[model samples]
Target: MRAPALSALDIHLFQEGTHSRLHDKLGAHALPAGGVRFAVWAPNAAQVRVIGDWNFWAEGDAMTPRTDGSGIWEADCPQAAPGQAYKYRIVTPSGELLEKADPFAFQSELAPATASRIWAGTHTWADDAWMRARATRNALDAPMAIYEVHAGSWQRENGEFLGYRELAHRLAHYVKDLGFTHVELMPVTEHPFYGSWGYQTTGYFAPTARYGNPEDLMYFVDHLHQQGIGVILDWVPSHFPTDPHGLARFDGTHLYEHADPRQGFHPEWNSAIFNYGRHEVRSFLLSSALYWLDRFHIDGLRVDAVASMLYLDYARGPGQWIPNAHGGRENLEAVHFLQALNRAVYREQPGAFTVAEESTAWPRVSRPTEMGGLGFGMKWNMGWMHDTLRYLREAPVHRRWHHHQLTFSLVYAFTENFVLPLSHDEVVHGKGSLIHKMAGDAWQQFANLRALFGFMWAHPGKKLLFMGGEFGQRREWTHDGELEWWVTGLPGHRGLQQLMRRLNRVLTEEPALHAFDFGPEGFEWIEADDAERSVFAFLRKGPPGTAPILAVSNFTPVPRENHRVGVPLAGAWQELINTDAGEFDGAGWGNLGGARTVPVPSHGRAHSLVLTLPPLSTIYLKGPTRATNA
Candidate 1:
């Protein structure tokens, strides 16, 4: 039997599990002979046939299995052409026919319609300058404030979803004006259920046709790239939905998933986990990761639910999971797969990065695989987000008792290359909006939000704020409607929006705020022990010769007069940002623009500044040296 003309190297890599470019060989490839070559892996199939528009949807064209017992079936159809819909018809040992969508399909019929389409086109990317500068832009010390967005819900026109082409222009302008460095899109992969929010992906390769075609999505990325905004895709590689046309039960066998339900099923999500032990499956997933970087020019991938992948007993109880060979709960195969994935992405896609949404105390999550780590560029600082929000949710009177929550994150702040994410997960499922999470009256709530954001920006880490949060969105996020854009016209909300815009500008412009975010040298405590006043102060440092900035926050509603905060050097200090400024709809109490330092040692510093601290406010002060003031 003549198998598909796969090279010896490709076969070896597929079997040994190191091939990351399976897209070149699998699925439907347009042949130069006015036809297409189709290949699928159905090891347990008794017979496989190609049934599509070219074949009049009949099973007359049977595929030949590889002579080397690789379980891959292939066929060359001279009559099959691009833009035709197709599916694999496999006859199982039980004599039952199973039809499935192509796993590597580049395009598919819009959801509720599952047939894969023969799509072939190359996008003309015009972001060469952006691509070349990405390495410097994404470096560890550079500013990276991500604006997280759900494409379908971010904006709509006349109650209908805007196509990617439209979003390209709109989103690019908004993010650019707001001073965000990157835009992280929620999954855009094709999914059958809109409620899943593209998480339960059915098409790993196809961009959801809900937002126009694949090329439209490419255009969207290119537009953003040209506008100096990096695009990061939220990729889900942990599990897949068990749709009939998806990877589940392919070839009437558990070809892609584990045969054992104990290891295959995700109880929480009701999804099927990949059989990471399989070399071919590893290659398939790796290829999917690279496909985005190679074809779509994606800047990075934020891998979802990594904790679930790291542990075999995740979301499971006793007797429901199988231990690894070493009798541990860790999924060794999944670990190897993740390492391989990170290695492949870095090796193939220069200036691209990967982030892990891991919630556990998984050590070395952002460290390199060569050092026995997961090798991601960053990891979500879930602990910080939870603890900080938990503290802010309490009234100022009770915040003192929970003061450790505000200070706990700093204990391990630099453990990983962290991104303090205020992601969609925090504002959904009754958790309430970020503004609503603050505990107080309407005015106090807005002040608390402004203070929280100021503190977050001043903290040592990269930042990511979800859509709507910047404008003081009062409603919880729903994947169905637009953000509370109207709130931007209101005084408090509008001020909050302006405050955030200025915060982004400060975060990007102040080298002391972003430089060395991953190390302790960039951060130092000025007065972390001031819990009685519910006030916190810290210092952020830049390069050796650059001056440092001091951040002070007053969580209580009562204003403090003659608030003495330590300074490293003796000179004039200016208020850079005051959350209570009149422009931010606060009472406008401030230090009359600037203050001179006194020669009084405090908090281990030789000089101190006696300044008025506004109620429920946070202030950023740059000083201690005339150079910084100048």
Candidate 2:
């Protein structure tokens, strides 16, 4: 069999650095006529050969370079079949022989073994209905409760990792039962070290073989989609590990990364950063992003460590980094690369979105690219998470001093389409678990946690809670071990889990809580300056014709009887959820199911309800409807 040649257009686009579908041309593709066609980009290589088990690991199958000066080598291996491990044998300009894995491999050998496997996509997709309806399901106005999970440690069988096929059913059923709209997986892409948690990626196009094969990962996404659950993958483009068999020093030069350490090396992570100024590198990353959405049916990508990519001086001291042409801290090349990546993703995969895990206050991160922004669908709200946790850590007596921590988030809440993330980062690295972060006795701690969840759900943004937080895991998160699944057996922990389920339910069922999450129209402050009593009251409103829902929270342990809270309408208000209710392991102190508003004015409203506010609890009320009050 003769090697299949790349088309004229393929070569042109690849050299021009605009090829978003390079996977179709490069990598090992199974030719229908006979065997496999292997292609790789090694412009500086003196010679390249295809060596694998089929050829007894010999150097006979030499690849021919393209005549168009594109520097891509191609070869035909009639003997190469699926499942066989293979690698590239490149002779560099310095006469150095380098054994490198194919950069565009669809499947890779399990870590500790460095080789790429010949894989032809064989998974049959059954998600047409989901693909068709996802536009509405993933709309900006729709309720989005993301459950962030680390696949390797989410669950285990006999102290071993469960394959993707097994994890798919278990994770899907669990997320669906908890009412989460999507599952955000912590990077499942292949990495050399399990300790890195897939952040030090080596295989851009392959799922980590530790969990399962390429087909198994596809089944994971397919199963989630079939169960009405969207899948979001954590994508790392900021830096990669300096593994010799990886992308570093390919063809005996910095082919994928910058040659200068000042510009290429990531000081904080001790990894190599890609040269975003290189057009070919941009095409490689863009193709990788599209491959997952196109082949695996993934709903979205949550880009990790975007803050490091945006600023040149990130994690660097003075004179340790290079600046842009304007002598600013920003990396203009990275900015352009990010804009192109986002534009390509949105254009190629309709309804699929991208999120940024950016900690800095970069303006308009979630805005459109045309509007002079980075163009992400949503951004993680690090400020809100930090403020809320800091406030919760203070003792109740001192909470009054930190009142701004709770209310300050609302000052800039609508600046971007935000996702209130209580992510794995908060529960690791000696930060302790969410339950342990609260400052009080056991009962008060649980109550504070419950109140925090209530406040988060009622706040104006999408919600994302890490895996073990729902059940109140007592220990810090560990990538080496599974979550504390047994904690759910305890009453307080079980009650917390129950509250999470109810919170997700309310977030989905109530339009007022989700419809305008990105705008100020959805939220109105009823009473934001109750610092003396450590209390807050707010109203979440929907579009016209929808009734408003009220949220009131008390941070202190002392209950407030006859607490006067204003309401928008003069009628009956039903207590939809009370974190202090006995069902959630709290003292049964609340308005007896509902409250009727009096004509007395309060908080600039025409009517008010004099009700009992429970200690360390948040309650949501909905009412003033014709069916209930008229």
Assess each prediction's global lDDT (C-alpha) against the native. Answer: 0.91, 0.91
Alpha-carbon TM-score of each model against the true structure: 0.98, 0.98
TM-score of 2: 0.98
> In candidate 1, what are the lDDT values of residues 1-630, reduced to their tens digit?
434557778888988778899988999999875888998989999999989998899764789888877888889888998899999998998998888999999998987899999998778989999999998888889999999999989999988898999999999999999899999999998888988988999899999988888899999999999999999999999999999889999999888899898999999999999999999999889989999988999999999999999999999999999999999999999999999999999999989999999999999999999999999999999999999999999999998899889899999998899999999999999988889999999999999999999999999999999999998899999999788787889999989888888898999888889988999988989888778899999989887667688899999999998999888878888789999999999989888887889999888888899999999999998865324422
lDDT of 2 by residue, 434-498 (tens): 99999999999999999999999999999999999998899899988799898898989999988
Candidate 1 runs further than 4 Å off: 1-3, 624-630
